[model samples]
Target chain A: MPYHFYNTISQLRQNEELVLYDRVLHFSEEDEQLVKDFLKIEYETESLNYPFTPPSCNAAAALWGAKTVYTACQLILYRENKEAELPLLLPVYNNEMDAAAILSADLCLRFLPQALQQTKNIDPDDALIAVLENHLQQWHYSGIGYVLNAATVNFDTVFANECMQQLYIDRVIQKKDMQRAMLPLLQKKITAAMGIYSATFWKELNSDKTHE
Target chain B: MAEDTSNHLVYWMQLDLVHKDYLAQIRHWDNLKIAADEQSIWVKDFTTSQLESIVLKSIPFTHLYYCKDNLLFPKSSLLPVGKQPAFLWTPIERALPVTLQGFNHNFFGIQQQQALRLAPIEEEQKVTVLLATVQDAGNYILNAPSIRLQQLKWIFINNKDALIIGEPVLPVNGRSYWQKGRFIFPVGYAFEFTVLEKIAAQQIDSTGTHLIWWIDEASYCLLHPDVLQPLSIASWRQTISNSPHKI
Candidate 1:
């Protein structure tokens, strides 16, 4: 067999096992109902008033679950406001928050060290990681199950879902390491797609943060 | 054949004598060493040295530009809406260097008909600027009397005024063909409607009716041959008219 064929075979085996494992792990009556409702709305071919599907709903769910695990592991992470309530998170799964997440992740990777080097009072990296975890949880609750379920039915849907899953894994792992390791790959892909590379938007909570 | 030196001259005459072997290499090496030695040397000096033996780039054609807020309707073809006052440009194609420079120098000499007052075109989005056939223009340039030559570029009208301003850059998405060293005034019905709407908005004043200036940085004046002769005369005339108008 050709090298590529073996590589592909191994990848396919891993993916199938992943899908089975995810189904076993995330499946529940509540998740199934939410997925069914979202799918009905999303797959409605003839509806004139369909709500906008958020960007990468499936990917958001995987991130959400992963982040919940991370937060529970970290112990210091906690819900500080009612804003952490799940409703606010649905928008993130809707792609409304994707750009913000991407930008935050980009900035944290870029400026956090410089910020730490200059001042000891703040660890923006921890805050950034917390935000990422929150968004991941939102995605887990919002729409990842629908996408994974849809994947079993449509190959294209599955491909898109799997690609985002791979990207999430890649980005999260790279985030844990450093942007220098992963940003170029993300930038190359994004630039290929959009002709522009952009970081996430950070909403400053306080006006008095010292300028870099 | 006699060379025509009436327009701007971009010629290829003599740049082939530079030594292209060891001398060029040694010069390049020397320059590299000097540049590395001092980073503060001005870029202009560097360019002057780099281009010391380069051949001049040739222009494909010489063009004459006539700009006005309103161009008159030629005496013959008068549509009711077209009869309105408008500024029109006439490009004299393939102008000789002397004539081109002459017109550039003496634009005011060109006589204006009662209907054809020269004014800057304003907000001329998609206006119909004129184009005359070379044969028709040639006859005017070569055969028209001096007074007529001075008035070579004129707008004529039967019932209404003749002058319209610049056309708007059309709401477009693609790269403009005009961007590629070409003229880009609107033409036909769309052109006429744009000119009409813009002219209807002009505020007349004592000096003359004001016109919109659609001067683009990388724009060329495209002229017809007939328009060129008069434009040169008019340009000279304008200078004369403006220079401390003899008491």
Candidate 2:
């Protein structure tokens, strides 16, 4: 029902504001576990050692995350000329984006990169691109290796949590993503972590010492 | 500016992805055309290496300059990833530092007069850097006094891009060394953090040149960097010159 609701909202099939999952028992136990399964895998890949513990799936988080992804995918793929209403449909998320919130939302948000790619393929000039791109940056754990707009990435929220920062760095190394790795915030820490043997670990870290 | 022979700048001319071809097998590689291993293949004379071009074309590779007295340097760790480049003239399009006479970057391997001779990075493979902690009293190797004379030699020899003066001072503590791969300094004792290099004495200015400039890589900033691995500018640059110019 939540998936249907979000997808309908994006397709102009519905225009309702999102609802929280707290105090709502609309989904089954199996569904909650299934959603948590997605976050678990992404956490492992990211080296997030925060100990994925019991009741990992928060109901409100699952709904918000699923809603965001389902609506985003539909809008990205189908909302061609419907550019003006993008912000209205997928408004900036002003939620408390702590580690728990982000981890919880990754349940369905992880598919964001694939959806974004599909939309880009359909119509690169799609208005929905920016809308979802902003969301992808927020839900970046799922977007690992997806090559988001690295320059615009604000590390304020990421650095707020110790565990998330570590996970972020690990994923960057796991992918050997040079673009994100070279960011000033990450560069210093990663440089110190790898130390003088930087070349031995990641040769791709070299800069193009040439001049224009 | 002084030049370092060990390291070199790599200019990339990306291959079209539409074309289906793998790197050609290596048949011959020399110091002038050093293909020590597949990681990097330094070509001194880009013109005569017609045969080498065949292998190069198939595989992704970067090349360095053949400058004065084999002093090849000016490392580039600043290129963006993920775009293919169109190089009309890969080497000439950019300037080498005045040290080598025509690179945009002012970081010449030379300073005043002390020139540097770089050794090959293809050092003894599989040797890890030793890490030891030194305690002051008994020379427990915790970053001081305990590291024996031998282990210190191994790390300095391997990682010193710049040359060191004389031998390392033995730790004041008793003989001790750890086997982990960390480059911890032997604190407690006075140690100089000089990078290793064969400094060439000089009096020429390494800078203040009316260097030419252009958007050398603006057109290719989006180029993918997978094939570009310039040699480790891992060597050190020290101006032992009486009057060294700022590089």
lDDT: worst 10-residue window of model 2 chain A: A46-55
Q: What is the per-residue lDDT of model 1 for residues A116-177, given as tens digits with 9 covering 90 to 100?
A: 23222344444444444344333321222111122122222212433333333333332322
Write one digit per residue (lDDT tens) for candidate 2, span B118-147: 222322232222222212311222112111
Highest TM-score: which candidate?
A: 2
Model no. 2, DockQ: 0.01
**Interface RMSD, per-candidate values to 1 decimal:** 32.2, 16.9
lDDT of each: 0.28, 0.43
Could you list the CA RMSD of all candidates, in the order they appear? 31.4, 30.3
Quote the positional error of residue B61 for candidate 1 in Å: 44
* Candidate 2 chain B, run of 10 with poorest lDDT: B212-221
* Model 2 misplaced stretches (Cα beyond 4 Å): A1-59, A76-81, A88-91, A140-151, A207-212, B1-247
Over 4 Å off in model 1, which ranges?
A1-35, A43-182, A196-212, B1-195, B199-247
lDDT of 2 by residue, A1-212 (tens): 35334233233212323333333323555555554454455434332223112124444564567756656755554444356867776666566666767666665666667778888898888777778878887777767778888777778767776555655665676667777776788887666545554565566675421221
